[model samples]
Target: MVTLLEHCRIGPPSAAAEVSLPVTFFDMIWLYFHPIQRLLFYEFSCSNSHFLETIVPNLKASLSLTLKHFTPLAGNLVHPLIGSSKPVFQYKPGDSVSLTTAEANEAFDFNYLTGNQPRDSDDFYGFVPELPPEKIELDSKIIPLLALQVTLFPNAGICIGFTNHHSIGDASSIVGFIKAWSSVTKFVGDEQFLSGNSLPFYDRSVIKDPSGLATKFWNQMSIFKIESLPLNFPTNKVRATYILLESDIKKLKDLVIFKRPTLVHASSFTVTTAYVWTCLVKATAATTGDETDGEGTEYFAFAVDARRRLNPPAPPTYFGNCLGLVYTESTHEQLKGNDGFLIAAELIGELISKKVNNKEEILKDAENWISYFGELLNERISGVAGSPKFDLYDIDYGWGNPKKFESVSIDGDGSMSLCKSREFEGGLEIGLSLSKPKMDAFAPIFFGGLHADDSMPINPKENF
Candidate 1:
């Protein structure tokens, strides 16, 4: 059980009225109604009275100061009544972000928090905030852009969780916000220190839509009337974190090269994604009691950052959504076969190479990509979320670096979150969600595959 200690609203330290900012083409793609929640857990080996006396007060104050610049985070998102008009993010005076402070009834050890293995899915939900959509009336309803919750585990630890609407911003923007908050929290008295930090760049005009992909994207999404997801915790679901050492990644790449010597550009991202894809499918087959040579289909998808991929790239600080959903399809047999990892690697490698090198290609096919994702919306698909490049672990809020960081929302989408290893240098950490039975079957295969020898069977690459 989780006990809500208090509920309050945190607004900017000062009043500011900002214009109704237009949502960019990139933002329009993700206007679908959903809250993306993530959490950072911190453990302090001190008395409960010490934690509440010292940390809570500073955390609340710094959060308020942080909101001074991040007013949009405290604001709400609004859409036009006309179907053709794109939605805009609006910040009204006196508006603020909802914050809740809570205490958990269950006790979990630091090993459970720090270990890279599965935990009871229910254990973490107490930390997540309920980001309810706003509904003033039939036409003029406002959806809260962000909400936060901080939970105390007595003397054991504390967890800071945030829930934000995807339409408000992408992962980068969210991380940027956290970094700013942490900076402010660290240098609470130094206004100059806060001024020197990176502020959010909210100029949506920088996004150009020559292909009219925004309208196409919005229309594609509008076709499907998605119901708001319930606030229920997942049942019988388990989450685990696994680390792939830098050496392991290199070995995997080398193994791929040994099989396909000409594949020089096979990357760490490609091989790691391929390895996960193969493991997931095999695990799925085993958990569900599917035959070894099952004939159905499986799919893998991931978001591609288009900030630099576009023709005239958006600024590094350009806020709002700037990701394109990219996915590949495969047969169950192909992915579960002996050459599964190799085949998966080639497909992922070729696609990534094209995306990174041939920027114009994605721009040209932006419309098609939107349509393609629409079709997959109702299908059973698995994909990857979060990236090691984001440096999620570095988000330190005064006390120390977070003991663990989780993209909790990904559990709903059945996708894995990838981050750089916290303990091991040059290693990749994967966050996975599966039913207990599947996880029981998955652990051995996942770990054993890491130690598997070279000389696995191969299937020739057909697409590349």
Candidate 2:
């Protein structure tokens, strides 16, 4: 069990002025999507008194100072009630972010929560705070952009949880905020030593939507009431962590090339996602038998950061969302067959190569994204949450590198999270949420395929 200790409001330092930022087309894609929730565990054994006196105060102060630079985070997304006006992030003088403090009972096992083994998905909900409910104010709807929680495990470590509305920012923007907050904490709330180059660029005008995609996307949001979207996660799911060492990725790449010699883009991201997608397909077929009809389409979707791809490339630190979707689909039979891995890898690699090379094509289909995603909402689709490029393990708040980082939002959808390995260089960590039966069937298929000889075929039925 977990008990709430305090609920405090934190804002930027005194003298910080109000600011407003226009929402871009990229941001509208996630306007009605579920919020992104994450947990970062740090192992620092300390008494409750010491944690309250030192850690709590330090984190609160550092976050306040950090918000002075990232003002939008402490603000709210104001969606205009009038049909003509677009949504914008508005920060008033008294605007602040919610910070909750909680303590977990002794029964909670810190090690088990941070380990690679499967654990109850509900165990993580306590650490993550929820975004404030949307409110109607004046002529606009006010939605909180970010909320945070710090949970103490008594003599064990502490867990820092973050829940942010997807419309406010993407992973890159959030990571930048954490880096700034951590830097401030490490230096004891000192901002002088912080690097200016690392600061976020909040100029939304840099994102050019030549096709008027923003207005088009805003019109699509009317199709469904935002309140109707699913926010409650499934309780029967179990969360697990899986690792792919450097050698495993190399072997997977080699296998793809051997099967499809013309394959041009077999990077770590492509191969890892392809392999996981194929494994999930087979696992679902083996355990649930829901999409085994061979004719059903299995879709794989993920977002690509378009910061550098934009014309007159936006700064690397450009805040808010600058992403494009890469959606690919295949028949169930094609994905669960003997050559499924190779097929997935080739399709992903080809699509990625095309998008990476042709910048003009990135937003060509932006208008159809909502409808496309809506169609696949309840279908046999799988998506990815985090990216290996984030290097999340490197985030240190003076306590040390994170013991474990998880994207808890994956439980809502059948998506997975990927990040660079914490202990191994060039390795990758994949976080998965599935029912017990599916997870049991997935382990062998995932590990057995990695260990199998090059000439041998991986039979999911045999493994099960």
Candidate 1 achieves a global lDDT of 0.76
In the range 1-464, model 1's lDDT, one tens digit per residue, is: 78888888888776576647887767766666457889888765545566568777887888888877778888888876555666778887788888898877656565586555778777777788987667774565577888899888777777899999888888888888888788778777537435765667777767887767777766776664332355465557888887777777888898888887766468878898899889888898887777644666677888877788776888777677888767777888888888988988887887777765577666666677656766675665778878878887787777688888887876677788888777778888888878888888877777667667753322112100
lDDT for 254 (candidate 2): 82
Task: Name the candidate that leads on lDDT.
Answer: 2
Q: Single out the weakest 10-residue window by summed lDDT for candidate 2.
A: 455-464
lDDT, each prediction: 0.76, 0.87
TM-score of each: 0.92, 0.95
Residue 458, model 1, lDDT = 22
Best-performing candidate as measured by TM-score: 2
Worst 10 residues of 1 by lDDT: 455-464
